[model samples]
Target: MLSFVVRRVVAAFGTLLLSSVLVFLAVQSLPGDVATQVLGKDATPTAVAALRDKLHLDQPAWERYLEWVKGALHGDFGTSLVNAKPVGGEVGQYLGNSALIAVVTVLFAVTGSLVLGIIAGLYRDRWPDHLISTVSLIGMSVPEFVVATVLVLLFSIAVPVLPAVVLYGPDASVGQLLPAVWLPAASLAIVMAAYIVRMARTSVIDVMAGEYVTTARLKGLSTWRVVTRHALPGALLPTLHVIALNVAWLVGGVAVVENVFNYPGIGKLMLSSVQNRDLPVIQAIALISAVVYVCCNLAADLGAMALNPKLRTRGGRTR
Candidate 1:
């Protein structure tokens, strides 16, 4: 287990490094110049040159990338062009907010998916299965932004049950935060639950078809016992992969949803940075997001291996 974990950790670090290179290259290759965006259109050529020199943009691309990589390793993500504040500091605040929402969304999604999926699988070909499948399909079909808009229209505009925007305004309290955050969280949860439900349902069905499940049933185990005890554990291994992928997607892919709802998250922050051509902020957020994705995938792989004796034995044989 220790060797497995170490290998996964090393792989995750390599993934993060490669992601940083890709993000840096992509940001550098963007059409507009960061210096131009930092300075207004009215700025003279000499002024733009000065700004570029100051930002080290006048240097070769490889040199700039090396400096940025060094700074990033030292936890210095550079200063934001727009705000002149440390990019890491600004990203940290938004990351905290985004992490909270992501955690809550994942919790709701996993729980809801597991419950619905178990029922659907246990009653395969029955009404419960049909209903769950239909609901999951609908949830997956509709985009999160559309869901956020509908939620805002129904809950905020019409009924006034929750606030349309989630960012805490001046003088906002904990009481005020709940109603504000509820819609965005719900929007994310709804989209995530769809994937989870489908994955869980498929896993459960596959597990149920295995000989061990039949043996458990033949041993006179109760239906629930056979499903939950014998099947659920095996079923969960596959579901872990889906959950990990969704968690990573939620980390960065929440941009549209965050923008629609005006929620302050890492995704929305990245969007704003891109619009303004804020390279430091954009690169920092991208690197952080990539780290999150790689780590989540590693965790999922480890979890799946841990839960399956067959996988553990296979690893041992390979070793």
Candidate 2:
């Protein structure tokens, strides 16, 4: 297990390195000059040229990339082109806000989906199953922005129970934080819960039909015990994969939801960076997001292997 974990960690690092290069190249290829964009349209060619020189934009692309790579190795993501603030520092602030929202969203999504999915799977052709399936389909069909708007309208504008938008302050308390983040988190959770429910339902169904489930049932185990211990454990492998993939998705896909709710998160930061043509911030956020995606997937693989003895044996043989 130790060797397996070490191997995965090494591979994850390599994947992150390659992903960072790709992200850098992709951001660089976008239209417009960062220096000119920052300076303004009225800036003269000579002024733009001087600004580029100061920003090292006049250097060869390969040289610029090398410099950025070296700085990144030392935990310096360079300075934001627009604000001149450290990109790492800016990202840290946004990441904290985003992480809080993402954690709450995942918690709600996982809990709600698992309960509904298990009920639906157990009841298969019954009324509860149909009700859950219908709800899941509706949740899946609607876009997150639409959901966010509806939530804001119902809970914020009409009822005025929760605040219409998230407000961050230096002195914000934990009690105030919940109301601030709840709307956006709920919007994200609703969308993600549908996918989780569908995946869990299918996995549960597959596991319930397996021979081991029947053996457990025949051994005089209660239906609940048989389902939870014998079937649910086997079903969780696929659900775990879905959860891991969604964690990465939530980080990047929260842009629309964040924008709607006016929540401060990395997604919103990335969107603003694109609009402002802030290349450093854009590149840094994209690289961090890509690394997060790769690491989440690696962690999921390791976790699944750890949970399933069969996978551990397979991994050993492959190694």
Candidate 2 yields a Cα-based lDDT of 0.85
Question: 1-319 in candidate 1: lDDT tens per residue?
Answer: 5666677788888888889889999988988777777898988999999999889987899899999999999999999998899988888877776776777788888899999998898889999999999999999999998899999899988999787876663233445555566777789999899999998989999999999999998999998898778898899998998999998889756888778877777788888888788889988988888888898899898898778766566442333
Can you tell me which runs of candidate 1 are displaced by over 4 Å?
Answer: 167-176, 314-319
Cα-based lDDT at residue 157, candidate 2: 86
lDDT of 1 at 300: 94
- Measured against the true structure, the TM-scores of the candidates, in listed sequence, are 0.93, 0.94
Tell how far residue 261 is off in model 2, in angstroms: 1.2
lDDT of 2 by residue, 1-319 (tens): 6667778888899998888778878988888777778999999999899988987987898898999988887878888877888998888888877888888998999899999998989889899999999999999999999999999899988999988777774234556666678988999999899988999899889999999999988899999899878888778889888988888889767888888877778888889888988888888888888888887889788778866776666444443
Q: Which ten residues in a row have the lowest lDDT in candidate 1?
A: 169-178
